[model samples]
Target: MSRIEVVAPNLKVRLSGVTSTIIQLVPVQARSLGIATLGPGLPEGLPKMRWWQVPSLLARPATRRMRIWHARRNVEMVAGLLLRWLFRAPMRLVFTSAAQRDHQAFTKWLIRRMDAVIATSARSGSYLDVPHDVVMHGVDLDLFHPPRGREDGFGAAGLSGRFAVGCFGRIRKSKGTDLFVDAMIELLPRFPDWTAVIAGRATPEHLEFAQSLKARIAKAGLSDRIVFLGEVPDIRPWFRRMSLYVAPSRNEGFGLTPLEAMASMTPVVASDAGAYAEMVVPGETGAVVASGDGPGLTAAIERYLADPGLAEAHGRQALAHVRRHFPLSREAEGVAKVYDRLWSAR
Candidate 1:
């Protein structure tokens, strides 16, 4: 077997943007280079190295002078450091920062130890005290594409609606789930043909919040119109079913859902949080509203509800925009260059 030149560590077992990134990009990167993911919860299809293979990393590979350990989380960074410094593994550490907030002292310390750093967006890079490259995340074009026909998507969902508008993410205040529900409550009644879909799960702490939103829907007699499908296994098909997508997040660390929706040829109405503002092209692809502005979110979504033709045109533009700027291959290539630079410096 070829020695692994690059190892992308996903320390978290739960599904997240970081985990999704690894799952999507590693396969693309592996086609041209010696890359494999290390850690848990990844699909079996991807190229992966086992925990038992740690000993082999102690020696320098004949194919490369040193292995590159790419870490997306603090725990993953710490693991890389232990391998290189504590265990004397022949590896170079690289960290990717997606957080758009000020780093804690410990996080700052961990970052300083990395040989190279990558920021998911320019906004993310601003929060980093150290030098880093800005490499935005991308969507898999093959996995998410425009539906052959409108019914092709809606029929698969088995939902009763002529049109669908959706918001997908964790059901929590920070993610602006309540804001999405409020927007739907006000708009769905106005446009009787459109049904609002919310896909994601609320953890133990936010179950009450999710229930409260449901109660609000029931109180307004719009529970049937507003459907909640908790934590979907595959969300690509749902994106195809939507006529519009809303990312009303109050906070985020370079979110990817908007891009995924765009790739599905679904126009977006997103709040100016994370990289939503960066990803969306107002009036052309979609609109961007201020974070936590319930009125603005409702108004933005209403534009599509009022005119479906405009929405469809904008969806076409959105698909083209994402194809040009945010293909998964582009992201993999950008990340590969960073790895190449580290290797060249050796």
Candidate 2:
């Protein structure tokens, strides 16, 4: 029998850096301040820092970076709490972006007891009555910038140049990819020239769903109407090719993709869920529809599809919103400040 013990150390620290892309302007700063991160796919460029694998903690029984624990998802918080209890240490847990922040008393209380708090969106911060920081999750600004060609390339991409709607990212129910598909099915007949390009992989459930969606499109004889560019590793071209972007996610702690699409100068069509309200302004930077309503999604998409020249105007507004609100270094710097403050206190 091979067994291992994890000594949670005098001060156990947990870090979930799954969202922190190494090249992003902010994460570089957090690592410099010794924020021990644990999660999948850490940036290889990070220095020889003490990064403990949450699962491998059982064998090490070491506790060096156990002072300031920060995470993004609920799963990360659970792992941090267990580590703190196992090590008999006082933990300062900070969840970067949480979905169930409204009615999540247990999760909220568990995190509030910690020394500090952080939220990625204003809505997430609004609920808490504590000393909290709203540091949005950032994107690779260099990678996602104003698209080239017509600034309206949708014209060339088999779209009417008036109504080219695009949505990318993993195909899933939560992402509302299904909603987008259904909306397109209902609206495409009215505007046969309008195109909806669905990109990215699908979950097992949605794999079948994706197939069904494809079947429906084919059955409706819309093989050319709705294009499926599945799982594109290089999404820049897709962003550049579309006049409008769509995100119907059921929920999001912080919708970074819309930000990325905005940064790429693509006007958005998103549900008023999670970070969409903060990012997309109805009839402004982008359009917003009621959450869980397929008709709303259809109407919002059609608004931009109806007027693609507004794409440039709408995209510029979206870009300006992102520029004024969320800068790249914001999240990492806030996280760094937390570490500096905590470290200095110690």
Candidate 3:
């Protein structure tokens, strides 16, 4: 078991959920793989100081004490470069943002200096100008697998009779939740049994926008057709209740919710952003829409809602895709091999 330290410094609530999923993956399968955090409140119940500032705060001598570091996100690059210089901590930087292209050259340069790299998808791989490997984020098939309705609260909440189209993950403009809501308004007349749900935490910047969304529901006379269940600790129960899942992200390194939806056997309609083109496989595993196309989202949602057998077919195909290309063991093994190769080079 090789110990690896992950240093993602996010104070946001949503960061914890995603990072926790990653931290649990590398260590559990890689035999004692470990993480050290540097930032304001990390995503998981991580053990370490708020390392968000550690890169900028560390004294030269202090940095020399550590051996390996994992920098999370592109924003942390400056600190990553400084630490690499101070400690020679053969670091492996992970990037999930596709929003920045102007810095790609510099990012590529910095990545090449690192011992190795890990990309979540081919789009994510393009950020690297060095030796790297692709490791699809692994989902706990058991935890997220076809969720059983052990309790009735999720269903009994009166969302049971409708075609539930739920979206999960951080709520923000980039996530395109507003666009999803607009599409929901369009579908209310055609599909009276449809409901759109906004799950996960929304940023303070978007809180007013969420209110506007709720107001739109009331104004459109579709309050009965839409709902908002704010952030919850465990998503399994929520995922279980969903009949169809939607993703309208302006961007994604890789959308984990769609896979979670597939694991739950809920059908998916997603924006063709980042890795969705490769993973979703329109008309096969799931339906996909243009990033901001409300009509496309509405049309795709209607298609899936109108055809349960097709939804099941696409969902089954999605399950098979996950089992073949993105299983935890496959992802873990790919990453372990990369670690082995990097160590060999050292």
- The per-prediction CA RMSD against the true structure, in angstroms, equals 1.2, 6.2, 4.6
Error of 1 at 114 (Å): 0.7
Local distance difference test, candidate 2 = 0.66
Residue 105's lDDT within candidate 3 is 74
For candidate 1, write residues 217-281 as lDDT tens digits. 99999988899999888888899999999999999999999999999999999999998999999
Off by over 4 Å in 2: 1-26, 30-36, 47-67, 78-92, 101-109, 126-131, 149-163, 344-346
* Residue lDDT tens for model 2, 205-322: 6788778778888988877878888877677767867678898988665666788888887889888777788777788888888778898888777776666678779988888877
Better of 1 and 3 by TM-score: 1
Model 2 TM-score, 2 decimals: 0.78
Q: What is candidate 1's TM-score against the reference?
A: 0.97
Give the Cα error of residue 18 in candidate 1, in Å. 0.9
For model 3, which pairs clash? 16-43, 38-51, 38-52, 39-50, 39-51, 39-52
TM-score, ranked from best to worst: 1, 3, 2
lDDT digits (tens) for residues 180-290 of candidate 3 = 888878776777666777887877888887788789889998886777777887777676677778888987656677877777777678998766766677777788788
lDDT of each: 0.91, 0.66, 0.65
Query: After best superposition, candidate 3 residue 264: deviation in angstroms?
Result: 1.1
- In model 2, how large is the Cα lDDT of residue 180? 90
Best by TM-score: 1
